[model samples]
Target: MTTNLTQHFLLDPEVVFLNHGSFGACPRPVFEDYQRWQLKLERQPVEFLDSRRGLAANLRVARTALAAELGTDADSLAQVTNATTGLNIALQSLPLKPGDEILTTNHEYSALEKTLLFIARRTGAKIVTVEIALPLNSAEAFHDAVLAGFTDRTRLLFLSHITSPTALLFPIERLVAEARQRGIWSVIDGAHTPGHIPLDLDALGADFYSGNCHKWLMSPKGSAFLHVRPEWQAMIDPLVISHGWTADNKEPGVRGPFGASAFVDEVEMQGTRDPSPWLAVPSALAFRRDHDWWQVAAECSRLAQETAARVRDLFGLPALSAPSLSAPQMVAMPIPPCDPIAVHDALLRDYGIEIPVFEWQGHHIARLSCQGYNTREQMDLLVKALGELLGLEQPRRKLGQA
Candidate 1:
């Protein structure tokens, strides 16, 4: 049964929102928590803003909770604005030289690709993008495609935990292990992984991993975390430098407390900013516990699987990934020979459904995401709308006219 609590989100009431995989929807309770922190900061700028120690303490609490969730030490995890920012910290901090190659898959997010290109231009390094064939059938095929990218010049392996456009979950564990065995650095872009799927960073064994708390954890925007292994901590220099660099009381050249230096020292103090989103992470976790989000996930997964199956039956296209390999909460269904943009626009303008549709190397995919708020009636409506838009009812219409 769907809970009434799911109705508290701020998404448009008229539209069927299936794009929670993009920017997440925050519940009323978590939003209130975020506002409270903002109010506290506003009440006393001097006490809250001036005191680095106080802000750091609050940040410490949030980081501790996030670290516990990801299965890593608190010191190794730093609270960033989002997964992309954390990813930038890892990619930019790398001490790459000319001729070094950062290997990645062709299914990477466009923003991250631009970041890699920027790094390549600056350091004279090469970006190696290996293609993983679509309708990805097995883990062995993915592993082989990634391993084939490894070469003597390969210095780093950057891959997504869950690809953005394709909406397929990659088998990162095998790739991480292979990179470690070959003495190459592994950086995982886990923007969509944390809340959508189970995460055990320590067991996953990636050298650097970054994820968004806002997406799956139901936190407010700007809530994200970056996890770094102890050995690779020294390589990262924070994107911002403030009082963390030098002080009258502290010793010179001292990093902050988290890593070799403080995690906040390198990253946290980015001039005047709001820390409310980061501070409200714990409250988001509390909301999940209070509402039993695990059960919600299971229900959502069932709906996603059922919707995907119906779409597949209607289209007669092959399933992208097996049930066992992919999470039931999200599914990518192949669209038949049609203009992806045209079909996507028609769905939105005609049906009033909000879902993601895109092309991946000559194949069109209509990716649907099911959350607790979604209803079976909504899925039925979507199926009917898609069928009508795809001309699947052409014969029936002709018979009726006759």
Candidate 2:
């Protein structure tokens, strides 16, 4: 935390970036590693792609690093382009009968919700949505909302590990356990989870989970992974059928260090494309270790908590979650009722700050992400800009002036 780590990243110096959750900003060294891999591929397309050894080794190394960091078996996980791609693959492979219900919370990422809808349309599956009340205080509040939507027809539970809109980390471990007791499949969207918080995919025990390395792990874009529990791996197919379709499905130890399961081989054996982003995950893990990540995470957490409290008070809006239940590095704080699009544009153009402003479930909110590169000065600038746009005095300065 002592180092001014902004020098390592490749962000626009003129703009204050507060939206790390959307698309992560990669560091110079990691970006260089990515470019190096891409250039190597271009130089000898046949040598890189045809040999299969290099790509296979890179995939093993990346998955090994991720497995160590995320607490799951390496073979059970396979790299994908992004979380959305992974979700589509999983949803498509499911055996949904007519009128079977796929239950999910309202706070999920919109695109994935649309994916579920696509699946519903293709099959005769029905979608059941649970409305979780805001100003949630504990894990019990989350548990209640989810169970309220369950019925005899509920066959699968799709929920976010960390929701995109509300930014609250759901208490999924117990829910997954309860679903297992009743023979239900749990599909989790964990796009925001990798480096935002500690991950233990095995312990969570969801039947399916998809997470993005590009968002929080500081990897290149187009890097993510889908993890299927061993029981479900055989049934899940590749999004695109390539050479792997003919490959042996039950061969044990066919691949290298991480090796090929029918799952890993089928999903990863697609034809030629740039694999630099997935390959660069090892470098991203190394970068995280070289810097003191614990301290960096702590600093970001403190800043996030302070920003959330101040913003919520400014608008007289309630906290969407308890501090521990909310993410340490990101918070979806409610702003006073105003045109969020206007405020968003003015902040970027007039104040040179980059962040996200969106409407979620009929409320306008701003989600802020504090990274190692950010400082209190940048936060103060954001607070000032928001105050002027909202036509109010500085919220932090006028704490007790009621």
- Name the top TM-score candidate: 2
Candidate 1 per-residue C-alpha lDDT over 332-368 given as tens digits, one digit per residue, 9 for 90 to 100: 7777766677677767777778888888778788888
Model 1 ranges with Cα > 4 A deviation: 1-4, 246-261, 393-402
Worst ten in a row by lDDT for model 2: 393-402
lDDT of 1 at 236: 75
Give Cα-based local distance difference scores for all models: 0.82, 0.85
List, in order, the clash count of every candidate structure. 5, 0
Per-residue lDDT tens digits for candidate 2, residues 40-103, read 9999887787535476777778888888888998888889999999988888999999989999
As a TM-score, model 1 comes out at 0.92
